[model samples]
Structures are given as C-alpha cells and as structure tokens.
Target: MNNQNVFYDELCLSIYTTNRYFHQLYQIVLGKYELTYLQYMVLLNIKQQGKSTLVVICRNLDLDTNTLTPVVKKLMIKNWIKREKSVTDGRSFELFLTNSAEQKFELIQIEIARIQEKLVGDDQQQFTKILSQTHTLNNRVQELIDELTNKK
Candidate 1:
C-alpha cells in the first residue's frame, strides 16, 4: 500500500482508540455520580442552556426523544434535575438544575477540566489548532451522516 493509505489506516485506528479511551475515562469520572457519559452530557447541555425543553436537548445532543427521555427521567429521579411546566406551553416541560445538582456540578466541572487538560497537553497554540480542526471534523461527520441517513 502507498504511504498515504498507510497513514490513513493509522489515523482511523488512532481516532477509534482515542474515542474509546475518552469514553472509558468519562465513565470512570461519572460513575461517582451514578451517571453514564451520555447522561452527563445531557446534564451539561441542560446546564449550558440554563433551562431547556426535551426537544431542544434532543436536538443539541443529536438524539431522538425516545433515546433522551429515559436519561432525563433518570436524572429527575436522582434529584439532580427537575422538570417544570413551560410558561409558554403548558403541555411541554422544561428542564432545570436542582440545588443538589448545582453543588455536585462544581466538583464535577473541576474534575472534568483536569481530565481535559491532561488529555490535551498544555500547549495553547496546539489546543487552538485542535479546536479548529475538531469543528471542521464535526461538520464533515454531520454532513456524511445526513447524506447516509437521507439515502436510507
């Protein structure tokens, strides 16, 4: 095989392995709070939005309602989050962080930041470049997913 093809193969493996490692690390970190990685992501999405609806969380997380609902329900049951009737739409509910969640979040955020710094070395310029590339990579991946799904 050509050098380019060899490099491509290596790159694909590296990406896959890195994703697996990251997922494992996230799970370990989140286990203390009894959360899965996806659940933590849902919490972050809700926290970032301040108050969000199920539809909005689903869209942000690239998940469907069926997939997201159970995670949301679990968080609610844990008393980490709560759902309130939407002011504009009584039929729909909005999600918010409970005070208990807020207390836990301070430590969670700190630990996550520590892990991020460890995974991503402390090179400012390199981190900036990686962030830029990641945005492009995400867009391309989304485009491919859309193309494939539309064909189905």
Candidate 2:
C-alpha cells in the first residue's frame, strides 16, 4: 500500500482508540448518574445552547437524528428535559432542561472536571493545544466529506 494509505489508516486507528479510551473513562465517571457519554453530551449541549431544536442537537453532536431520538425520549421520560413545539417554526420542537436536569448539571460538571484533571494533570496546556488542533482537523475532515458527497 502507498504511504498515504498507511498514514490514513494509522490516523483512523488512533482516533478510534482515543475515542474509545475517553468513552470508557466517561462511562466510569457517569455510571452512578446512569448516563452514557452521548447522553451527557446531549444534555451539556442543550444546557449550553439554551432551548435547542433536534436539528441543532444533531448538528452540534455530529450525530444523526435516529441516534439522538431515543436519547431525547429517555431524557424526557426521566424528567430531565422537556420538548415543545417552536412557536415560530411549527415543524421543529425546542429542547430545554428541566428542574432536575438543572440541579444535576453542576454535579456532572464537577465529575467531568475531576476526570479531566486526573487524565491530564500537569499537562493541561498540551491537552488544550491538542484539543484545538483536533477541532481544526475535524472541521477539515467534515469539509472533505461534504465535498466528496456533493461530487457524488
């Protein structure tokens, strides 16, 4: 195989491994709260964005609606979030945190901070730099995917 192919394969493997490792850590930290990484991410995003639509959640999380639908349903059932039809947009519904979700948000934030501190410790500067670089790379990858899909 060509060097370019080898590089791409290695990069993909590294990304997958990193994601898996972090997910395992997240699972451990969030286990007591009965939340998965994706679920917590959805909550956090909604909390940050303040009354977001399903399309916004899907886009922010880089997940499809099918994958997010069940999670949102679960959250609604748990009384951690609520959904309501947008007054301006009849087709879209907005998501907002419930009282319980707001109460738990600070605890979740503390746990995540602890986990991050444990993992990165003194190397936080390097971790921040690497995370920034990863964001740039992810955007580039998305652009490439969009270009390829458009071509097809």
Candidate 3:
C-alpha cells in the first residue's frame, strides 16, 4: 500500500484504540460513584446547562429521549439529580443537580484532573489543538456518513 493509505489505516486504529482506552479509564474512575461514562456525560451536560429539560439534553448530548430518559430516571433514584416542574411549561420538568451531586463532583474532579495531567503533561497548548482538530474531524466524518447514507 502507499504511504498515504498506510497512514490512514494507522490513524483509524489509533483513534479507535484511544477512544476505547479512555472509555475504560473513565469507567474505572467512575466506578466508585456507580456511574457509567454516559451517565457521567449526562451529569456534565446537566451541570453545564444549569437548568435543562429532556429535549435540551437530548439535543446537546445527541441522544434521543428513549435513550436518555432511563439514565435521568436512574440519576434521580441515585439522588444525584432532581426534577422540578417547569414554571413556563407545566407539561415538562427541569433537571437540576442536587447537593449530593455538587459534593461528589469535587471528589470526582480530583481524579479527572489527575488523568488530564497525565494526558497533557506540560503540553496544554498541544492538547487544546488536538481537541479542536478532533472536533473538526468528527464533523467531517459525520458529513461523510450522511453522504454515504444518502447515496445508498
């Protein structure tokens, strides 16, 4: 194969392996809190939004209500989050972090900081650039998927 093709193959494998490794590492870090990686992501989404509804979370997380509802319910049961009736929309509820969540967040953040330090290792600028490039790559890959699906 040509050098370009070889690099493409290597790049694909590296992306897959890196994602798998980080996901497993997150699971290990979250295990003590009885949280899965997706659950942790959901929490981050909620925290970022401050007051979010299921529809908004779905949009931000790129998840459907069917997939996210159960996770929200489980978080409620775990006392990590709570839902209050929306003042504007009586039909829907707004989700918020409970005190328990705030408390545990600091503890969870300590390990997350450690992992970030290990990954960054005095290369904050490089890490930020990689994150930006990865986001662009993801959008380009999504466009490719859309085009291929349309052609089918």
Cα-based TM-score, every candidate: 0.85, 0.84, 0.88
Candidates' C-alpha lDDT: 0.89, 0.90, 0.91
What is the full ranking by lDDT, best candidate first? 3, 2, 1
Clashing pairs in 2: none
* Candidate 2 vs 3: which has more TM-score: 3
Task: Please say which candidate is ahead in lDDT: 1 or 3.
Answer: 3
C-alpha lDDT of candidate 1 relative to the true structure: 0.89
By TM-score, the candidates rank as 3, 1, 2
Candidate 1, which segments miss by more than 4 Å at Cα? 1-6
Count backbone clashes in candidate 2.
0
Residues 41-93, model 2: lDDT tens digits: 99998999889998899998889999999999998888888999999998989
What's the residue-level lDDT of 86 in candidate 2?
94
Q: Which regions of candidate 2 fall more than 4 Å away from where they truly are?
A: 2-4, 87-91
**Model 1 lDDT, residue 41, Cα:** 89
